[model samples]
Target: MPTARAIDTSDRHPIRAFLDLRWGGPTIMLDGRAIDAAALPGFVALDADGAIAGLITLLDDALQSEIVTLDAVQAQAGLGTHLLELAAERARALGLGRLLTRTTNDNLDALRFYQLRGFRLHRLAAGAIDLEREADPAIPLLGRHGIPLHDEISLIRVLGAD
Candidate 1:
């Protein structure tokens, strides 16, 4: 298996292209806009064949770092966990004491996965779905699980950094 490595911005076109497949319009404009390059950190895990199997992006914050995007193709194969571990490690290394993530209420799998990984349920933004819809009307109001997307569920995991 290939090891996790810091994503090289110079050679990051492939990574952006891959993420575009999943987030082009369905989720966010991860690749729709040109990157500023001076943005936050990013990383990826490669499989044996040098193909990116997982990707993650960290958004720096004064209080805690937000895990903006985490995608893994091989679910239940430890790819997600590996990426999470790396996030935690990077957070600690960067002096960030905690990590935060937000997902739509319709994402039950994400809810379950975060909880199972020691992320505590924090709070829910009641009008998140409406707000998102207002910002981007193209975003569907229904989730994959048939749940009406009305809010965002916030979760937090304290990193042992401080």
Candidate 2:
């Protein structure tokens, strides 16, 4: 129902909102934290009507990229996959070896989504979720699907088609 398009410069606010929504809420990024305005080169996928639907952010260093947040109002649509392909293209163009991302143990859908797209298990931040709670007690202990959020699972996909 929606087609993907590049994110516009004026769309920065919505992109930030997507990050905040995914991260639980607007709060300071702990440690080496970077968001839209701070993230030097980012991409977003717009729906047919030109609304922000999904986004991917890549740190300038180019070694890694964060999905940041990707949401498709219509589940049956292929918007997510399109955004992912765009991200991969950008990563390849940047000559990055691979792209890395993290999702909570409770995000079963994300686990499947990334895995299905060729991302593989790399590492699990054993206490990152707890550290997050320490930073923001308001961060939900439970995930969108009601599963208890415990740890962050790191996943990676080599940028080269090899």
- Candidate achieving the largest TM-score: 1
lDDT of 1 by residue, 1-162 (tens): 347887777546766666667667213422133333224476788888878788777777787877778888788888887888888888888888888987888899999999899899888888767876776798887887799988878899987732
lDDT of 2 by residue, 1-162 (tens): 455555666766776676566654433342336354424355666766776666555554647665555556556477677777877887787777787777889988889998999999999887678787886687788876898876889888888774
- TM-scores for all candidates: the values are 0.86, 0.81
Error of 1 at 133 (Å): 0.9
User: In candidate 1, which residue ranges exceed 4 Å CA deviation?
Assistant: 25-39
lDDT of 2: 0.68
- Worst lDDT window (10 residues) for model 1? 29-38
